[model samples]
Target: MRLALVLGEVAQGLRRNLSMVVSVVLVTFISLTFVGTAILLQFQINQMKGYWYERSQVAVYLCTSFDGGPCEEQAATQSQIDAVENELSGATLAPYIEQVEFETREQAYQNVLEQWEGTAIAELASPEILPESFRVKLVDPNQAEIVIDQISGMPGVFEVKDARAFLEPIFTMINTLSLSAVGIAALMLIAAALLISTTIRLSAFSRRREISIMRLVGASNRFIETPFILEGVFAALIGSALAGVALIALTEFFVGGYLAGEITTIGFVGTSDALVVAPMLLGLGAVLAALSAAVAIRRYLKA
Candidate 1:
């Protein structure tokens, strides 16, 4: 009997404030969409980091005549290149240094020309313009710095470069954007919560006379409160559901259809991730609804 009364009151309140209920749903949907996008962006960043880091390598360029040093006066003796390779092979810091390949100036130049087949610059430069270098492939890319630092200042070494160095700035920028999205989502959610609370307060105030009659007839505060609380809860649940649906659609159409193929490393929220987010959104909505109703009822119940 009590449950039925609660349900009936909830239905009545929803019918009376249908527009306000829709507003709550819209606000929650937008807020959660931003929050979900932030989550997926961070996930993509991690995925790309893991994928690229595994393939990262260190390149140690040997001095050539164009390097402008003693290295030019006398081409790096075979002994100097041998010594550097031996030092790398014996290093304890990166026991996983799988192999190092020494590319001569001619081979380096050929590779460059192959990559720039259609470029005008390729026609202007000769293979001799390229420097000889040691390309080190590691079992663990994180240890690249160790190898780079070890060989950088050595005699006949021109420069040390890590493939990952060029990508670090891009990842940092992505992280910043993800954080900014989360910040904006938080602010928007707060606004949504406040709007929900105000709507509940006004609805409860309009129904105060009905509540007074129930109270006068010896109805408990719980009896009077349940309907208002249920109204908020229903509104929140609808909002969460709307948000979840929007997120899935966005991921499928925008992320999967377009971005996924273009950027292999960028991943959207998968089905499993969507399932996980669904409950969180529902819980968030429920909590917001319950809190809003509780605050609104406090003043009425006291009066």
Candidate 2:
């Protein structure tokens, strides 16, 4: 009987302010979606960082050509290559070095051509301009700078480059965007909470006379509060459910289609992880709604 009455009152409140209820639903949906997107983007960024960083290596390009000139037979000698390899193998930091693989200019050019197949730009550059390089894989990517600095001044080495250097800017931009989304979501969520609170307060005020009569009839405070709490929870749950659906659809459409093959390094959160977070978002929304309603009702109950 108590549960039925609570449900009835909640339904009545929702019906009385249908527009406000809709506003609460839309606000919560948008806020939670933003929050979820931020989390998922962060997850994707971390995942890509881990994946790429693990495979990251410092490339030491041997000086075989100068000033856009072709490689001369006398440019980089086999002796210099062997000396570099021996020095790397004999270093005190040898244990941290995974393995050093040498790629000839021919191999590098072939790789470039293969990657740029069907592109007219590939034909513009001569393959002979490509320089032979030592691909130095390290056990720890963070130690790449140390290795690069050590190899940079070597006789035959012209440049030492780490893959992370090229990727840092892109990641920085993504992180900035994610943080911006979070900031916007926070502002919207606060507005949503305030709106929910005001609606609940109004609903409670409308029933003040009935509540006072109930109090005169010896009704407990819990009985009076349960309906309002339930109302908020129900509204939030609906909103969260809608948000989750939208999020999942957006992720699937964007990540699975547009981004899947475009960037080999970037990856999105999988469906399994998305499913795991859905319940948490829903619960979070419900909790937030209940808290907002409770706060609004506190003074009225006290009076």
Best by TM-score: 2
Q: lDDT of each prediction vs. the true structure?
A: 0.81, 0.82
Model 1 CA lDDT for position 296: 74
The reply for model 2, stretches above 4 Å from the true place, is 67-74, 116-124, 261-266
Tell me the number of clashing residue pairs for each predicted model.
0, 0
Q: Give stretches of model 1 more than 4 Å off.
A: 68-75, 91-94, 104-126, 264-269
Clashing residue pairs in candidate 2 are none
Q: Model 1 compared with the native: what TM-score?
A: 0.87
Candidate 2 lDDT over residue span 1-303, tens digit each: 877877888899889878888989999999998888888888888998898888888888887655222233335678888877887787665977999898987898888888787787567545577878888899999999778777776777667899899889988998999999989989988987898888888889888888899899998988888888777788888999988887787777777767876866556677666676678789889989999988888767986
Cα lDDT of model 1 by residue, 1-303, tens digit: 878888988898889899998998888888888887787777778988987787777988877666675465445667888878777788464476877888987897788788788798778768666777888889888878788777877887878899999999999999999999999999988888888877777778888889889989999888888888888888888988887887777777777777777876545556566666767777887897788777777766786
Residue 276 miss distance in model 2 (angstroms): 1.5
- For model 2, how big is the CA root-mean-square deviation? 3.0
lDDT of 1 at 52: 79
Clashes of 1: 0
In terms of lDDT, the best-performing candidate is: 2
Residue 21 accuracy (lDDT) in model 2: 86
